[model samples]
Target: SILSIGWAQWILSDLPQDSLSLAMTHPEMDWPTAHAACPVLALAGDETLAGCVPARRRRQLRRARQAASRCGRIALLSASGSPQTFLDQLIRLHNMRWAEQGGGVLANAAVEQFHRLSLPLLDAHGLVRCWLFAIDGGTVGAYYGFHHRGRAYAYLGGFDPAYAEESPGAILIGHAIAEAIREDAREFDFLRGQEAYKYGWGAVDRWTMRRVWTRS
Candidate 1:
């Protein structure tokens, strides 16, 4: 199964005890569990990114900025145009990075279609926050997220590996966090991952549980 392929955990913590009744109603169906770990950055009142991150990370961000600056100018563009215009570039950059990393959800047709349709609606409601990073007039990275109820969720992001030494992705994320702080967002959620990099950004672990119900 795809879940197995992805090494997902099968949790039965919330499954109903009366399995016999469930079997009578629906038979031969197998259930799978969904797993996720959300890494969150709690923002203090009017805190800046420099204030939120550790001193070491602050230094790293500073150095990254310096390295990237030599290429010309590093610009962070967000919600500056129609969602339609941004989606194509966003997906293209995302796919480019994912392709280099083996593969990702963006490679899936359904997921691609979902973003293509959902971004417009999210943008219309001002819930969507999309950002692109450009160096010397060349697009290098993109981030798509949602801001709602005083929280900013970092949904997805991608950067060209060709600029890996410059760390454009990290630079873009730092700017996004700074923007969220300026907007007075209470939390910046790096949704659905326990990746090591999230911790470097001063994120704390918030685990999400899942349950699978099976008929016997």
Candidate 2:
């Protein structure tokens, strides 16, 4: 079995000690994708990464949901970026409801590192729309929202864990909603989060039907 990335790593192993991968030089894709060849051997029978994840391992759960789908008495507001007030509100809501821990972010922010990773998803989907939330001059949070069909999907994201106390992830989603309103998108999705805050923002679980193949 050969993983393309491993081959590159092996072939290019003789470079200087501080050297990087040759794939990094490709200009067609964004930096994140250009150098994103990880080692993996997808066997002949594997169509997708077919494996069962334990339900107790919450984070590994596969999800494809419409976060802003019609399912609540949603209070809508419009903007291109999320205002500071909204970030405070989500933090307050979460704090007041201790049972709602990890429901919202209060002060997390985004930096160049976050953007580097997201640029790939954007290049992968030419139509992906992104929004950034800067707090005190540093990018505290970023939302990689996807606009498809009538709704916007908040796909991948990043935030400053240093401001985790301030719930930067909440700010990112708030910005996603604002972007959605600006584009007149049908909805703004939080993608997938089990936190109660999403429910307050009116997130619903959407199950996806996946097909598995077997080789005889």
**Candidate 2 C-alpha error for residue 89, in Å:** 25
Cα lDDT for residue 194, candidate 1: 86
Native-to-model Cα distance after best TM-score fit, residue 85 in candidate 2, in Å: 26
The 10 consecutive residues of candidate 2 with the worst lDDT sum are 38-47
lDDT of each: 0.76, 0.41
Error of 1 at 51 (Å): 3.1
Per-residue C-alpha lDDT of model 2 across residues 55-90, encoded as one tens digit per residue: 322122122012212221223232123334333433
Task: Judge candidate 2 at residue 183 and give its lDDT.
Answer: 61
Q: How close is candidate 2 to the true structure, as a TM-score?
A: 0.40
Residue 88 accuracy (lDDT) in model 2: 40
**Taking the tens digit of each residue's C-alpha lDDT, what string does model 1 give over 26-102?**
23334433345688988764545666776677688889989889888888888545787677777778888889677
